[model samples]
Target: MENTKRKIIIVGGGITGLSAAFYTKKYFDERQIPIELTVIEKSPSFGGKIRTLLREDFIIERGPESFLARKMPIMTLVKELGLEDELTATNPQARTNYIVHKGKLHKMPPGLMLGIPTQLTPFMKTGLISPLGKIRAAMDLWLPKKKGMEDESLGHFIQRRLGKEVLDRITEPLLGGIYAGDTHSLSLQATFPHFSAMEKTHRSLIVGMLANKQKPAPSIAGLPEIAQKSMFLTFRNGMTTLVDRLLKELQTEHLITEQGVQTIVQEDGGYTVHLDNGQQIQADGLIMALPTQQTAKLLPNRSSIQWLERINYVSVANIALAFDEKEFTYPLDGSGFVIPRKEGRLLTACTWSSSKWLHTAPKGKVLLRCYVGRGGAEEWVQLSDEQLITAVLQELKEIMGIEAQPIFHEVTRLERSMPQYPVKHVEELRKVRADLAIHSPGVYLCGAGYEGVGIPDCIQQGKVAAEQLAAYLEL
Candidate 1:
């Protein structure tokens, strides 16, 4: 009789892959099923985009700074890993955010449900919009519901309901900043499905937003100011703490870093993962915790993944500058500010890291990080590091008048890393999944490509993939 014990290999050693390995081991261990697991990562390190650096007295995040606390996956995982005590929420006092309009920093109006003004008084008072623009946006209260279930571009939906100025000014910077993609091509259903549901349920986004805002929000003790607000939490040490803890749960020997997967040849009852290192790893089941394009390369049917290759990505650079607290002429109020595309600035957004998170910087020092690049602004990131810093500093001088040179600076570029979910992205992914189901049953895809780009989303994807593959192996 054949051995019942099964072997599984997970491609990629990032958060998604790590979580998949952890859960896969946990699932089979709980069921008392003999299983062997290996995780392959081409990069030298794990965590994919979750790199952190401790320089001087600052905790500089080369990638994502935090995960949404309300997402539940990361939060739950933290508790499970016994790191619950290390969790830290965003500063409650850092509630305000700014948007640069007409080359001036304007305070974002309160009561905004993702840039759609919900409160009448603040919306009318905000200087971010012109008199006519405000009037045009007010028309959303009276406009009929958009009549279609078809996937529509986010730009068209926002402009149709709120008007062009609102789209360019508030919605573009706020929503477009999230995906770092052209709103004209971004999918509304794939990005912000809640807005679509709002139109269907309330007939008007403004009404829906107001109704939702009035509903009692979730709260946390001792952080009443931001208790009901969207909470983004991170570790006291940095985002890397999560990755380091995950490694503890997974055996070090099972993880192979700095090794690339050259090919995946499917065979009867199993699959073979060939590494660039002249080694072939065989497995009964495979989990591809990689980007859609990378996964396309390993499959036999390239035609099915034509859409995957076409899924666009944008590059962005994170520039972290450390400055003495006294260097700032003006008070660094609020968390930070975002620049509208109309402003034509190198910086898409800037986060006052020190203010947003208390542990990010030591006392008497500040760490400010800015993102420089988006879809149309891709050329900016290609600039030399010095050139990019100069441009960022110039913008800072003009906007905040900070003249003192940074004590230290770090620039990290993520080339074509952020996936752009264009119109019909969800439908295209559905077809990809269906095709894979027919052609490759043991293979699974997840990460920033399909469901979401956030850390929590990736974690959830990894866990779900493990559960699905475990059942497939009948473990």
Candidate 2:
């Protein structure tokens, strides 16, 4: 009898796709099932937004710099790939995070559980807010829970519970910096569901957070030493270390870069994936780890994922500059500072890379990464490289009073990369899932577009999608 091998194709060889392929292959290999797996990537490389630019004694991360250490998926993947020793934690002593207010950097109040102050003493002593602003924020303790099951904007939720000062000075910069989104339009439930849950359960967010903090830390059976370090972490070389490891593990034939999927047509037993290079791939199952827009193009039923077309992506740029330690007029003490949108500055945030991660800069020199280009402010990418650098330098001089020029500089622009989850985004995703189930059963979707955007979340999505596909195919 001729052997029958189940074929699987994963589109978009990003971290998500790599993860899906890894898990899927693991499942089939253990069962002694014959399988042919292929991963297609449109870009010249496999990592997608995970790009690292290494120069003379400096590691510049063009994309995400780190992942949350507390998250299990990325940690688990790292260990499985035997890259555990390479992992490094953020500088624990440099724990201070700042927000720019009135052209000055203010240390975030201690005991803050994601912008909500759990301790009263630090909250009261903090100068980030005015006297009236502090009084309004204190009102959160007595304010009744917001009524309604409907989703609301993060801006409205924060302003309602903690006051406008808290929203603008604390929550807006902190949360907006992560999403590169507008707080007034971003979804509370989708972005910070924990805050929403705390409000629903305890009525007062401050009280709820305090109560939660009092509880014991969650336990994991065999977490490594790296897992117990700081909140955010990365490898000594940069985040691309994980990507490089994943790429190395995949077979050359299994990994096909620079091949974009033009269209996917549903056949009797499976689907035919047409490539941009005039090649076609037939597979029993397909995993789409591409962005919302790219994945939408390959779907056979366009109307089913028409809502995906509405998924808006925000462009972001990172400018990494290196300087001698003595070049700065003032001390670069803290981890970094986030510029509030209210500050009306060209730079959104700046990370003291040298202070945050020792490996990022050479000895006796300082390195900083300035973030630019939020949702509506994407025009910064259009500026000439020199023009962009000049604008950033002007802002840095004004904010940090540093007049000296940088020793080295690099610019990276990620166009339409960050996805914005607006209010009612969960409901919209729910409908999209239902439509996919009806119109495209054997097809699967995962990545920043659907569930979550964090590295850990994307890994979890890939794992879940693989398990579901494996079960459906009875492998």
Q: Give the candidate number with the greatest lDDT.
A: 1
User: CA lDDT, every prediction?
Assistant: 0.87, 0.86
What TM-score does each of the candidates earn?
0.96, 0.97
* Positional deviation of residue 378's Cα in model 1 after best superposition, in angstroms: 0.7
TM-score of 1: 0.96
Error of 2 at 299 (Å): 1.6
lDDT of 1 by residue, 211-326 (tens): 89898865543332322354788888999999999998886438899999999998986898899999998899999998878888788755767778878889988999999888
For candidate 1, what's the RMSD? 2.2
Question: In each prediction, how many residue pairs overlap at the backbone (N, C-alpha, C within less than 3 A)?
Answer: 0, 0
Error of 2 at 310 (Å): 0.6
* Superposed model 1: Cα runs more than 4 Å off: 1-3, 218-230
Candidate 2 lDDT tens digits, 247-287: 77777438888878888889786899898989998998889
